[model samples]
Target chain A: MANSIPAPRAEGLHYLGLRDDIARRIATGLLGPGDRLPAERRLQADLGIARGTIREGLFQLEAEGAIYRRDRSGWYVSPPPVVYDPTRWEGFISYVEAQGRRPATETISAELIVADPLLAGVFGRPVGAPLYRIRRRRYVDDRAVLVERIVIDAALAPDLLSHSLDQSLTDILKSVYGLSVARNQVSMRPCALTGEDAAALGVKSGLPGLHVQRLSHDAGGRVIEFDHEYWRHDAVRIDVDIRVR
Target chain B: MANSIPAPRAEGLHYLGLRDDIARRIATGLLGPGDRLPAERRLQADLGIARGTIREGLFQLEAEGAIYRRDRSGWYVSPPPVVYDPTRWEGFISYVEAQGRRPATETISAELIVADPLLAGVFGRPVGAPLYRIRRRRYVDDRAVLVERIVIDAALAPDLLSHSLDQSLTDILKSVYGLSVARNQVSMRPCALTGEDAAALGVKSGLPGLHVQRLSHDAGGRVIEFDHEYWRHDAVRIDVDIRVR
Candidate 1:
């Protein structure tokens, strides 16, 4: 069997060269965001490289967040990721727009439910207390980037669910409910995307994702809201500047 | 050919149950960190479930950071991840020890190298300027969890490479070089582990990893060190606290 198997091709350098070539095109804006790359066969014919070598190069670019493969579809150039600053109180729309990307939000579901044990602990509420659960998907440059699940004290805003849920929750709480966000506690880790979140972000299940959990506090330091956000691994970068002194 | 395939087993609920069972055990300390799980054959016999179902459950647990599989080895419980607060001026050893885990470091390589274009831009040094490059692997509970590559201006820290390179670079700079870290600019995103980083962490290549880049500035507001860290996705969580007022 060993003798029958073909010798592996020496495509290491070829694949690296292909990767750099594509990367340079992206950096120069010749391959804009969401622009599809040449098909594998086309790439092989154009560059005179093996199909496997082209695939290796594409995978490397995907790992570097330069391009992504859609299931059953070809590769497309990835948009530049937005920077997330946890210390800043700016909403997603503000920061994304500041970076010259269009931002939009869609409300998937909004309802009032009894607090679960986990939510109760996080919100310092009774387990049976009523809370508003809102699920929304956010987009940057028309690409779904993250899914956010937010829970707020229903009593704090009686008619919150009746209003538009697509807007920023921070603004809603401040302008409509007279509740200002004074502090935020955030924790983040990387994990595999769940099936539901993956569908929301148009990615494959089990792909790597960034999970961010936050607790928002009122002026008196009372926990007012809790949120869980699942972001496409390549869609956002967490930036934190610290002054040690 | 389609009919030749066997009907898929209804193992979804079973696998989830298995995942919950194992998670509960880990939470209760019945299965401690680094403890090898029962063999798959044993689990199949004990649970009376198909091998595929057991594997699915294991994969889910791994995604949740509860357990991991060593290549060619059985599954093992994962340690609780350590929390990293960029705002705090704490070394890895101090923080890992504070979390009740043993921390160790191994100097992989230390040398003087001419700054490349990327390093020159990051360090504000002229191209080809000499800089000290240090690569080290960090461990928690005897498990390699992160690899760090650090570049420092050679002129500022003369004979720095002569001392031990396995200890905390922050402490060394503070005590020996009279430089205190006063500011840090940190950026992090999820990425696929490269071959070199995966080998250093004793994992398979292409596994999900967390890539962190940091620029450390001293009290004089000069960039003193630029560091790149590749961490096991399951090994650490980033936390940030902000006061909006």
Candidate 2:
């Protein structure tokens, strides 16, 4: 890559508190994980300094895990990422709310569909078991964000279809069926939006999206429910509370 | 969000297999998050079905956390999300690989700049620390992507600017300083790109981006590094992995 050097600042590798400069860059959002630095020759020429000073600065940043250099790809920007603690099984709604963003939903088309092999496995019923389904679009303000369809065990939630679901299903289960979801898992992957989804959300197809799959269990370890959350890339942040091992 | 009904499949809901249909919509890019499904009344009219049947179909989909519904504005897509396990400390190289995507980097700009107070506090160094600042750009493929820079820990990484690097600094620490990182706290917030970031990523400012901040610690619990990763809104996906209690 060609150098896009701007007005030369202080040049030279002489150790005049270089570590603080590097540390400062990180604090102010300059350097990130997975970024690369220029060759030593160029750096020395531009900074007008010895190599030792730079090495010392890097050593400290490295110790902190602020930057990581691959075998060949150079240094990179590591986004502040949230950790998923498997021991905490709250649903997606709770996850968003935990981050202090309001979570809201709209009921879409609700209908019954015949289950297939996979649905059978998730619902834990025979193939072709009668399954109740609801398709809803979720959002943050004007952004028509995630489009999700939920499946229910019709037998388990007989009158579920008639109820207004303005709150959380887990809450509904607790109030109606005396069930408490004790744990859940969320898995995600990079995804692209489709024409139908685009048309529904008024977005163009091929835009990046996050596909989230969640599975929950009750206190007795019974599979409570499983759902997929198709979230827009821009409107959400998943937060995690972590502890050092 | 407008309600775009799920067109009845050629074989109807039974043959389409409720589970497979949802997955296909996501995988084939047919349905997207935030796309509102047709109103139950409209869906029945368009799909030539009873309203009650549509409700049953939607019920199952909601249980899986695939979508969120609002009380008034209709259903929207879930935003890009991830369930991360923070118990283990990791660099970007390992993290991206785990997601089944390749991460790459390039040098952007690097030079010494006067330390500001905020940076000085982060590094635990006195104010106005002279640092060897390095800026780098990162990418997934040919996409002109994220731009990141790092402020070296002026004391430990002496001569870090002297070496040609595009590799993992964690590895460098293991090989050179013998310092190992063991913990970190990462967080993210949604933001618009700055002129500098947007220009580097080939986009205009005011577009959305993920602004992340992290403080990294060492084996002895010393906070050794701080990091910031700002990603273009269109090109990145943050996966949320959760383990629930």
Candidate 3:
């Protein structure tokens, strides 16, 4: 690993060189995920580099999602990003467990809400129609990673709110309503965390996150579920394979 | 237009009401994209709210991708996010143009570099193989939005670097090299902006962005292009539709 580090030279590129060195350490498992990096002063003294240069390199690494910083705890290596393939449609639990990580979900709230215009539009129901609204906090290996709000049209399954709300909604739709997700319209954007989402994810407000919304339909082309998910950006990678026809 | 603004009421949801008011203004074209909002003090006075309340509303708008703030400049309504569909494989120009925005590209650098082991592994070639390296800055309606670094296997197209690189490489491969992209393996993650990427996109370093990479294979199953794209997270929305079989 020592041989892998480039010889320090050229003042302008020192930060980039240092970034590559730290990246190599992460790749070689010398620095594992959630492991705190040596303090800035320690790194500066050990590498004989200026503190500013070290910070610059660390900033580059942060931008690359290789590490993350807490407000006062300095920096830690980021967890291995969870691979998300929307085409699979197995939901969060299956995906996390497939990655060899334990998955858990907490039902924050489940209640009946009058459908708003957005909900009415998605579910093709009249405004003020009754609907089941479920809010959940999802975890991967005990780390709260996502907060989701799911709305289900009560006409499809009138007793949905009475059942377990912490499990996969897809599974519930299949078993309870005899409806399987036939297609999904998934869209994603990056945004700062709102106060509510930031609190749920236990991150600072205004931190960047990925906001994903999925409107799923059943075999009869009826909308089954509309879900909004806020994910900590550092913890997930979305993968897709496209075949050009 | 005044009727469109919701009445300011409720103790805890004042900021949310303010957010909705501003959002309606943007929707009605009263405040277009890139149009700056009033100063914090001015907004506080105009809305009869505390400075903290005004800040909270602006932060909510930012989190929703409805607005963005510069370092010294006050907030501005964000442009409608550019919709990106990787499955279309229409390349950047077509996608941007389809969204009714002007698409432009600047060739930052084009040269030949010796492929390292990583590049060699992707291209199934030996290390030190000659590769065409091209870096480009992309723009939407004159706003620089993305920076891309693409490496093409030069052995497949000996004279690749001699032509223009300001257009889509997918087109170039088909027209100049008689090779068309057959498939793509695309992965995306939320990341902060690296220094070089930040300078190109005119954003602060370590601000959130989306990092996407594509490894494209030709009709013969040979890797043709390895491309890395760093996009300002606020400027684009990724959409994918999947049909379950």
Candidate 4:
């Protein structure tokens, strides 16, 4: 792999060629996910490229999501961004695991709460209806990527708080309650992280993120779950295939 | 509308109620796309809410993608984010129009360029293949929202530069060259705008944006279009519904 790496081209577009060389290293698995790149000064010494050119190439790669900077930390190859498909019935754990990444969910809290007026309006249920509120943070490659708050119709799954709340909630819904997700109404928007969410994701408050809300229904079309998800913008790419029904 | 709006709640979470009020205005069409809100001082006076409270509410709405703040230009209601469905054969103009928004395209440049090694590998063609390069900026509601650079095989469309490049390239390919898009391979990631792109989109360089690259194949499975799109992060949302194939 080292022998095949090309030398930088002429001065005018040396950064482009340098970018290709680094991208090749990433594509060939020579630089795996979470592997930190050498410092800019060190890389400059090794490649015999000017610091400016090296910085430009690194900036381009970061913009392309091929790598990311962890604040004061150095640059590291980015994990493949998770592809979220709303139309599939496959649970999140199954699909994320299918991508050859370790997927883990940590329950932050789970408790029963009466629906607020806003929640009632969203769920179309009467105010004061009992709802099971769950907050969990999901991780990929040991990095926290997603924080979700879910509210379930407590009547449908009684004593839900007593059951294990880790792993895939969709799977638990099926095995414990005989419910399957029939469809999901998902909405996505770009947002900045709130202070609490920023702390959870290890980023400063007001850093841009992605906000995704999913309202999933059961096979009988009963509203089963309402989920609000906040994701680090750099950690995922969204893909959807729209076919004629 | 005034009577329907609920007054702010107690002192502690006053911003929450104000945010709900502003969100309701957006949802009810009281504040249409591109409609600018009152200045912070005026809003504070009208709502009898504190200035800090008003600012917090506005901040929340911006994070929710319901509105946006233009640098030095004040706040405005955001147009509904376009829903791009790659599976449908509809051209960019039609789907955006179907959502009741006017779509316009401005051609920035068109020329013939020899394919570089990267382009040759991506298109599965030999190097030096003549490719038609077209650059365009797209608008909705007269606001620049997307900038795209397309590279197409020039051998398939002779004299392509002579045709109007201000509309959907897919439509032009179908009508002028009898080439129809069969399917697309689309990938999206969060990106910060480049200096050139930032100048075009009227945003600061390094502002987070959505980077979408698409490879579209013709009916006979020949790759016809390679489109790279950059969009302002606040102006658009990405949603894709996946169904079992």
Candidate 5:
């Protein structure tokens, strides 16, 4: 076989052409972490492109974790976030640092949903009991790579919604309410991401995702939290050290 | 709102079309586990259909794990098979039986191959050292749902190829060689299936698969096996009861 191998497919990077410029500047050590990116209008004017084109490029860059944005705030360069090991079952913070990836949580949505038939039994509650459906996305290196939905019994966890949803739920449960995933019945499967999940994960629909569904309980086996994790395939691997069956 | 709403999509099994003859037979208990299925030629004579139509029916049935075929061995009514838990890192027999499914091993391929760059480190040998690459498909509910490739270091396991590839490697190592997966370093991710995997799993390419890559060793950390498990999306779950890091 020829020793020279063709380079990796370069088709998708064109959309992020300007993104490369920004990344190159960062890599060249000219711009450091926490440095702000130029505004869309200004970048467009400088680059001789339309504002919409610049906006799309910015979106692509943000999706790739090349930069970060604050709401009504500007995009900023950031370091890579930490990774969460699903197997370590650590609270979010420790796991992030362990993987040497940056980690951030943004509670995008939270709602009080009526526990319907299936969820009622799972949460060990009566039908129509109030349940907290908390939605959050995790960022690693400024790239949002995973989305999660935590369903907790509202009556039991009165302060569940009070805690920072953008932060680690594992921490909230322990520090705030003395709850833990003392025992979890977890099931993982592979699935093609739906349009909604794909958007949350910053990947295309029809791409693979790891569906981690858990029924978490207290030490007494009292059910406490129902967590659903939608994980990106590329950036994370669930490392399991299985000592027994 | 109406007391009952039609599903936005399929809630259960309605979308899965089951012909009356097939449905009735299963429903009426005329067909049962481990029973031989009528051959295409025989079914054509009995049901008065073209063989192509019969083949299509078989494909659907296979998707549902209602039927199975052996290579040149003919089709047989399927019995429920158990899913082996890679995450649990248990012996094959116990884990399978505990899941309320049968465990059957039929070794399709086994041979000694020289280790490559990556396998060298995993097997604790130099590149080009002899190793056994064994291939197996794990069945759940009589449906073959997983394809596994296991590499064994010949130094630790001389005459490895002589053992029945159909027997559980874990068992052979424990009983015959007194080795086992006392501790496993497993990394799992979601991936698309390969063409060979698709053929073995009776699914087309692009189907989702769980890639469970693992390093198994004894208490002293001598690497015994390096395994790559390609699993069907719906069949197995990677679960762990973790002590938080």
Candidate 6:
């Protein structure tokens, strides 16, 4: 351990140097988005620095959203986070494309299920009422960034599961079901990803994530859909504008 | 290592049972907000469970926001998060009081500084312009939960630094300077806590946190204040209402 230690100033420089080197590499396109970083052992041998110092530098980069770690796997450069404005009624595809990034969605599962007590309350239906539950994994530039579970009131859109579930649910609701969302009640918090969400996002369990819950209502004030989204903490930014008269 | 291994089902039960037992304790008032939990060794010895199992249970509780770790200090129960509506102009004290919690602020530092290029751009002033910088730590129910750094254009408020900064800056600007914030542009993202912020919040560095940045403007659309805030991830929930016409 003593032999591994470098002088304080030298150690600081080494870590900061590593962090800046990687950042510059990413900025210069030497390291592309989602490119895996070299293994820690390799970095240590090449940089001739302690593994602890290298880890500190990587953690700093993670804090800055420049890179992210996968459980058991190495770190990867992060893509630019998409700026999401909750005030806009925009689909994920439109926003991602607007930001010059490719977007894709994979339908994990879709089925009709009996509404639970909470779901019934949200939809103003009886507990036994039918609801279409859809789960999806959304990708930005070929890296899975979000997993969403949506519960839609089935009575409002019969055969909803028959439609291609890979596209935007908002667009599908408007085009096929003739229901346009007029309002959204959005709640968000920082959370730790667990189990299925972690697996879907290809990250380790207990990684930090952003949990967003949205309740979409039609012009008539009827609740049409409830969506629960878990996003990689580095994948998106939430923007809101408020005007007070 | 082999001695620490329990049967698979028993290990699952041990950890889940520990998690639920602690949650029940919290729900039943056996444990209160900010109350420190027993040491890991103490819990392991008392419950006759492996230390690894106990750690897993505690991590689960942390993910649920039922408790939080304090670096070298043991875990403590987390207070219920305050609901923050960024759309509202309500002050911290008003909302915290409304939710039956005490709110306090301590001015960590206040000084006048020369604006850097970033600050100059934000304020639409030259890089050498003088600005007032204020750093404050905010508390909810006796726990430090947020640290905010605010920069204000000195020309707008002549004696801004002379005023008490422990209270609401919004109220101060309105009452003293007769300037009302008519608009706010807010951006938020999940982040990892680092050096100063983590120290102020009494948590370990690299803890997950919520980072919020706000640009406040008056009726004339002049940027009045720029605020950067770091909050304990479990300390608050952000709620936004979007009306799409």
Question: Model 6 misses residue B148 by how many Å?
Answer: 0.5
Question: Which of the numbered candidates is closest to the native, going by highest TM-score?
Answer: 6
| Candidate 3 per-residue C-alpha lDDT over B48-163 given as tens digits, one digit per residue, 9 for 90 to 100 | 78787778787667656788777676787777779998777689999899889999999999999999999999999999999999999999887778899999999988988778
Error of 3 at B227 (Å): 1.0
lDDT of 6 at A244: 82
Interface RMSD of 1: 2.4
Q: What's the TM-score of every candidate structure?
A: 0.82, 0.52, 0.79, 0.69, 0.62, 0.88
* Residue B33, candidate 3: alpha-carbon lDDT: 89
Question: TM-scores for chain A, candidates in order?
Answer: 0.86, 0.58, 0.83, 0.78, 0.65, 0.87
How far does residue A168 in candidate 4 sit from its true spot (Å)? 1.4
C-alpha lDDT (0 to 100) for residue A96 of candidate 2: 54
CA error at residue B149 for candidate 5, angstroms: 1.6
Query: Candidate 5's residue-wise lDDT over B155-238, tens digit each?
Result: 888897877777677778888887866788777766556458878887654345667788988887888998888876656656
DockQ for all models: 0.54, 0.11, 0.47, 0.22, 0.24, 0.58
Model 1: per-residue Cα lDDT over B39-103, one tens digit each: 98887877777787778778677766778778888899988898988777778999999988899
Cα lDDT tens digits for candidate 4, A1-245: 12332565453366667777788999999999889999988877777777877877876676566777776788888887888666677767888899888889999999999999998987778999999999999998788898999999998889888888897888888899997877677777777776678888776455567888888877677788899999888888876543233
Q: What residue runs in model 3 are displaced by over 4 Å at the alpha carbon?
A: A1-31, A36-77, B1-31, B36-77
Clashes of 2: 140
Order the candidate numbers by lDDT, best to worst: 6, 1, 3, 4, 5, 2
In model 1 chain A, where is the ten-residue run with the lowest total lDDT? A1-10
Tens digits of per-residue lDDT for model 3 on A1-245?
A: 12333566454466777887888999999999889999888887777777877887886786577887776778889888789988677989999999998899999999999988978888989999999898999988777888999888888888887788788888888887798888888999897776688988877665678889998998789998889999888889999887766
Model 6: residue A16 alpha-carbon error in angstroms: 9.7
Candidate 2's docking class is: incorrect
Which candidate leads the pack in lDDT? 6
Candidate 2 lDDT, tens digit per residue, A1-245? Answer: 12333232364323324545655677786765434556555565665555654554443343233443333444433333223333455544676566654567778778877889998887677998787787777654334667876777776667776777655776677788777766665555445455466556655443344566766666666666667666554444544455454
- Candidate with maximal DockQ: 6
Task: Pick out the ten consecutive residues of candidate 3 chain B with the lowest summed lDDT.
Answer: B1-10
lDDT of 4 by residue, B122-174 (tens): 78889999999989999887888889999999988888889889977777788
